[model samples]
Target: MKNLNLKSLYRQIEREYEELRRLNKRELEERKKIVYAQIPEIKEIDDLIKGIGLASAKEQIMNPSSDSLERANEGIVELRTKKEELLKNAGYERSFLDKLNSCEKCKDTGVQEDGRRCSCMENRLSRELYNVSNLSYTLQRENFNTFDLGIFSREIHKEEGISPRENMDMILKISREFIDTFKINNDMNLLFYGPTGQGKTFMINCIAKELLDKNVNVVYQTAFTLCEVMEDQKFRRNEINDIKYRQLFNADLLIVDDLGIEVTNSFTAAGIFNIINKRLLGGKKTVISTNLSPNELTKTYTDRVTSRVFQKFYPIKFFGEDLRLK
Candidate 1:
């Protein structure tokens, strides 16, 4: 999984907020309208706090007086109480008032976070990610029903050891179990290695879709595309540091579709190893779909990478003839 693009996370958040508002339409509209109407005043409220924040900083640095600190504390308490009351009158909860999913440390106006404008920091990072890609399509594509297992053939399953329906039954059950118990079981680092058009990607998507519905963060990228992006980032170093390095290595679950297709090189090898190794170390789950068999991958990459994957990843060798015949 590449680092979770925060833009994707923000888009998901906004989408969910909208969905809930839509769901609660009868009572939500007036409350929502009031919040929207007050949006313009957010700047004014934010401006009002700077003086107090500045004084508190100065006191802490120069005099370190309990008196000035107490006053600053009183100001915060009063402002927050007013904000809470405002929210209550509007029928919006304190949670909704913190839109931008505001920094939990400082509430909405950025008066806190070590006495600096922390909201601006979070907003800046979010804006950088938002500029990378609009990931709304990726989110929608995770819908489980989008998978048409009919694309994989019955004769193919027989060749592998089961009927098509039997194979599907297991896959479906496993998928559901994975979703139902994800927090406890986590992902198994699934390897859907078998024939082309054998529903490997579809199965991965089914799991991704189910997990996303559970509010799990997920990222999808092909090996080639991921390497290309990483290479560009590495070469440019510091050009784009909006997302942290650990984020790419530690998504709750990442789906790398078509894993063995990237052109093998030292850089690509290291990149792949870093992603797989990091996830495995943290016990995070990854789902990789590939046309390559374990043997093929071992030959292409190092025994180390392949062995680590095979040792940890649960194999779900997809079986079927190409369904194009039917």
Candidate 2:
């Protein structure tokens, strides 16, 4: 399969990695300064630890005797005791040395043991390559943290037979469970269908955020953007497997938001079907949000596409007014 233009992505990811490293380094330095500023005497005590390490090394080499070893050991004792004093006086822990690992080993220099990649480098690179945003416009008033069930009316109970409040609460609960218990291959493809502002997209966004946080390679795209990528793959062929199609096909969680809202064409249908079919065959988890009802899905994409989705996906239908207006 084809992949992303790695040459372009590599440089971009590198730049992002560097920027993240700078941010981390600044934060670390600020924290260290805050810590050390309180204990100006740590300068003297730390100075002594370094002296002890060097002096012990030199003496052990030159003398290699019990007396020299004992004296060096005594110096080690004094150094540790001084560190303890510094900790107590500074109101800090004795393992203030543990605080030095902002980079965990390389001190944010980005080099690990024996010149291998450091933890900081790994984290930064991961952030760059992995931190993709589906809705970068900064979605407002919607987040997993603030999703409230009380908004759905209890009247929905008698009217819809399954109260909107109860149904939405169940959906929210199960979605959270699904995210927490997410497993590759075993995860079910989900179809969220309903009117606008019915919490379909918002709920999936919550799922996407949680799944991505688990380091799952996810693509959360508005259907328009999703169709564009599909068109790009089929027409211009500017992308590679690793970048677009493959990631979407194989992502632990793939969310196509506002499906059926895109401009419809043979290309769109084929592209969407291909994605759904491929993932279904592979047992990957996919999510599609749409305004179309079950019958409408059949009319739009034919029984072949609709059946594949119905049989393979856990169909979740959302109802009610655009909750956002409420």
Candidate 3:
């Protein structure tokens, strides 16, 4: 998946804040007009408040006495008390004319007074990630809570000596533990490999959702799509594709699903190795799911690539009848 342009994303956030401010201002004006129409005394009270403010400014410039400032403040308060009473009698709240900010803390500015990013900004980033990952719809249907243990047969397998449900139970436990303890610098990678329909992709989705909910940066791509992006960057040399290429390596968690399904060639094989090797060296986590067996993986990729996979990734072999059929 293409990474979102950071500049564009922040620009969009600014535009949203501007739109929210505009909406709030418009709504407050319209509501105040209605209130003034219903209670003409509100207009008079507001005028008095403005007059008091102007008088205080002039007094401060002319006399600059603490007594004069205190009296001005008391006068403003008295007018405000009357205004509040009139608003209450007119069936409106005291702050009815105030700006209705979507986020009261930041006043819909997406930043706090202390210069920290607000939750609204984080939410906007998450929304952008959802769009970039193209997993918004899938995540709704596939998460840890929604995973059905019943779908996996409980009967013991003749060869593996474990039921599908029992094996999945263990996998589920490990997945949960991984999410709870995930660290950017931890050398924890996962390789979920098995035949199709064994719920590998579903499990991957569950992990993705868990990490994403924590506001962790995650870039998910099918092996094919990843290779396509790499190929575009290698040949086309486009600036945008280059940014996406860097993002694949820099994401907190990179999930490359269906690893052996991409159109493998010298370029793709090299690209895959570079991604895995670089991310591992950088201590970034990755989760790769594939239909290839251990031997097939060794034969298909370079020895260095296979060696890193064996050393770095916690291998989880999925073996069960294709759940999609059920």
- Candidate 2 clashing pairs, residues 3+ apart or interchain: 2-240, 2-241, 3-240, 3-241, 157-163, 197-323
Candidate 3 global Cα RMSD: 7.8
lDDT of each: 0.64, 0.69, 0.82
Off by over 4 Å in 2: 1-8, 12-141, 157-159, 240-242, 261-263
- Writing each residue's lDDT as its tens digit, candidate 1 over 1-326 gives 33655567666655654654455554545554666577645335545566788889898889875688888878977776776666667566775544343236654343465786354344434334433234446546645666555554445444467766568767777777777777775546677788776667667767766775665666666777667657756774542442433345655676778987465787777777778878888887777888888788778876576576667877777666664455
Ten-residue stretch with the least lDDT total in model 2: 122-131
The number of the candidate with the highest lDDT is 3
Root-mean-square deviation of every model? 8.8, 7.5, 7.8
lDDT by residue for model 3 over 146-208, one digit each (tens)? Answer: 999999999898888999899999999888878987973567788998999999999999999
Greater-TM-score candidate between 1 and 3: 3
lDDT of 1: 0.64
